[model samples]
Target: MRERYEFEGKRFLVLGLAKSGYAAADLLHSLGADVVVNDSSPETGSKEVTALREKGITVICGGHPENILDKGFDTIVKNPGIPYHNPVLKQAVQKGIPIWTEVELSYLISEAPIIAITGSNGKTTTTTLLYHILNIGGKQPLIAGNIGTVACTVAQNAKPDEVIVMEVSSFQLAGTESFRPKIAVWTNLYDAHLDYHGTSEEYALAKAKVTDNQTEEDFFIYNADQHEMLPYIERSAAMKIPFSLQGKKAEGISADDEMIYWQGEPFVKRSIIKLLGQHNLENILAATASAILMDCDKETIENVLSSFTGVRHRMQFVKELKGRTFYNDSKATNTLATKSALSSFQSPVVLIAGGLDRGHSFEELRPYMGRVKAVLALGETAERLVDFAATCGVPLAVKVRSMEEAVQEAYGVSVEGDQILLSPACASWDQYPNFEERGDAFIEAVIKL
Candidate 1:
């Protein structure tokens, strides 16, 4: 296990008691700091709270108490999901106690250098691909952050020789103060998480924070196609390396339909890559730029490109049943992502879309409707999408109640050489906890067929 950072006699208040919060609280307690963990949930018997209590750490449950300030906390390690308007956080700010995310603690403790990646989409695929390339190139890489594992927990157990490759989210980045990575990547930006972030400008600002702490020696890899990010990129101290799919560039990475160009030279042929879609091409280019900048050889990069199938639930190939292929792009939780998925295919697709309605319209997706042979929409936006499909002049539009029903509907209309795609343009919160669960359900239903 990696050694804990210094915190002897320091008083820390940990808010939210979720995975990241518990990990931070536990770390602080282990380092001889006076730690108090608070959760709005009353279930003190929950595994995490119980474990902390077993460690002789203080636990406050049911509600956030006002007396937390009386405890004289030197720092407040907050769960990234918790809003700034939360009473405990507001009080902490009023009292002048510095609030930080668990990532900050992790960065302070980790001896390993980091490669942090963030964007509205494609973060997981890019991060996983980079991990594969780094491993093949002999870099001992550890994956963490929004992909699943808690960043601090990974950091606390990480060895100095390992390279921590984290898929960071805007939520995590918003809480960071000094969490600098040796290499920072912004895949691309789009208007997303507006419900949580309040505005697109705020969301973009949070993503930009990934490179805020970088120095002249660090590298910033980002999408040149997203001119919206240029202002923030210009302000960064790190050397900027941009990736694009539109045209060949003099510096950084870019790709056409045939070859991926790195610094204006042919890096890899598109025929060698196993993953599909224009979005996946962008992801590959981003990963390629990062790996090349990190000194990974061409042979290793090519091997990974040829072999790596893809991350689960994002353009994952399910099966070819009765001569029709199926793809699960459940991670396409926004209109832009769904459009990217749709634009990737030249042939007509029986598109299965819809999920929790996030107040965004289906109007932006109209242009891509020509490629969709039929529409099997489900979840909260089913009927609305069906109505929108009617306006798009889609040949067939059916509103289904469940994923199984949608899959069956798509199968019924599909013919030989056609594609059935599960590229929901909304979140999975209405039907499942996350997109993976929803995607798993779709895969399971397909297997049953």
Candidate 2:
């Protein structure tokens, strides 16, 4: 790990004690910074807190003390999920104290060039795919950020010869200042996390930060199909590499129904790709473009694309039991994502959906319900989704109380050639802690069947 002397003697405040917060605090403390970690959760006796305290860092828990900011800290390394509207953070802004997410720290200490991926959806899939391609192509890539591992933790031990592939979120990007990636990929943009960002424009701006500090020497691979991303593309200093599913463009990556082309040259046959959905094609194009920029050969990219079934919980093919294939798309926590998942299959689909109702209408989903043979709804939005499914002329709509019940109901409605997909068009918080847990439950239930 490269030694960073800049943090030495600095007084740093880490807000919120999640994975990112812990990693940032530990790294900062190790670099000679006087770190004070604060978590709104009341669990002061937690092992994470105890460990930080053991490292000579102050641990504040239970709540945000109003006077904590009065301590005159030089900078604040915030957990991405912690809103800027938090009382402590609002005060920090008023005081002109600079704040950063752990990713900024990752960039500061890392000897390797970073490849950051961000989007409203498909960040994980693209990050994972690019990492796979790079790894197979002998690029020695280290995966981190929102894909699971903390970015700072990965960067801590990253070597100069290696590359860091990070799946960054808007929450993380919003807190970054100089966290430029050598190659950045914006999979696609959509209305998401408005509660955290407060506005769509703000959310887009946050995602744009992936390329904010990138130079002409760097590469920005983005969705040319998303017109909303054009403004940000124009503002970026990086060399633009556009990927489109529409058709073969003048340059960059483009795909037809049969082939994926690189700068108008046929790179790979689309029929060989195991990943489902046209949305995934966009992800493929973005990742392929990134791998090319990383010097990965066409053969390596094709090999990875052909073998990668899908990212787990994101339109992942679970199994084909008695010829009724099941897919777990628990990551489809919004209408746009669910629509994409629904469009992936040609066979009749027994879709198990519904979760936390954020007051968004299911009307946006109506147009895509044609192939849906049956609907097994669950969680807070169950009845609402069933009612909506009825309006869409879906033959069978059942309200299921649990994931197991939903899976069983889906199987009951599905035939041998049909697909049973768990692509909840709402957040999992109403029934489970997060999407992963909800997806795991669905998978376990599927295995039982």
Candidate 3:
């Protein structure tokens, strides 16, 4: 209801007419900023675009005209899907226009505290889990960001006492200015989204911004297990909190002998998380650490973990037919994450993989190939993967196209005690809308069989 920016009278260019961009345009206008919103869509009949014109914000739907980015504007803010390296974004950067993401803009205006979570993987599970624990502990936390919700909308409408639990992505992180979370959590980092961020280091730099502007009073919770993040962690002067899943000597929170602990603070009750897989255990540790640091009641933390159902696409069980289990791990968009999903199963697996090739190495997928019954490759990357897995002793590999064929072939080749895992260690844009669609298709195919 309130305007955060005084830009109500200044010129602003809003790019990417998606949810965040539209919200950003409206928020700027509420502050008296003159804004023009653009979407690449070639049609002007969209309901949200129509609403923007009605609200008195300038709406230029049907495609982004190049002249728009060239014109003088006070600042530029982008939606999460708009790559930081886009030509328009690059031009804006060259013009020295102050660029910002929706998260950054929201942070600038919010009166409430924030706990922003960012990572190549694990952000959604960690963000949602943290929110669940906070609610159980009696805190009002609004969940938003790359986890399929507009945080700017939530932050704009929430009361001052309520906090924001944000799942920020690398795209959102790149253009951030003066955005800092009270408790910033970086779960882990791997080489992902090279198509957008260009290099793994650049991508990590964007993600590290979760703690970028943090002060010593703010908490920077990171994975002690990811050595790549250690350079940033060591240099961070913020109140450092680290979590681990293996060995002792880890500081902030850890799990030992089927028990979870936060900073040596024993939980009031012994808790056994119901989620399957060791990767889920890692998510459990991160959530427990952040909630405890937020001063959530020990009992609330324990209770929430018990009730926390895992995220939809990450290792979601479809069915057990003919004595073989089917798991939809469409969220495993990288080798490391897929490896984690595969490592959870002790039985032999007919692992269905391959998708939009992201320059990922199958070397990491090698160690776990022994447990995989055979490799079922799909999409553009299939042929190259067959050879890679064979190096790890998987002599039998089947190449198929589409999730249906992969599932059918897997079922034909697998028998009792073997698992059918759709854990493709690659992006889904080649054949699906997102990981969700890919995972959904995998489930649908399994149900048909």
What's the lDDT for all of these models?
Answer: 0.90, 0.92, 0.82
Better of 1 and 3 by TM-score: 1
Compute the lDDT for candidate 2: 0.92
TM-scores of the candidates are: 0.97, 0.99, 0.92
**CA RMSD, predictions in order:** 1.4, 0.9, 2.4
Predicted candidate 2 versus true structure: per-residue lDDT over 294-404, tens digit per residue: 888878887898899889999999999998999999999999999999889888999999999898988877888999999999999999999999999999998988999
Candidate 3 per-residue lDDT over residues 161-266, each given as its tens digit:
8888999988898879888888888888877777788888888888888888999989988888878789878766689988877644437877666566666655
Stretches of candidate 2 above 4 Å error? none
Give the best candidate by lDDT. 2
What 10-residue stretch in candidate 1 is worst by lDDT? 1-10
Clashes of each: 0, 0, 6
Give the candidate order by descending lDDT: 2, 1, 3
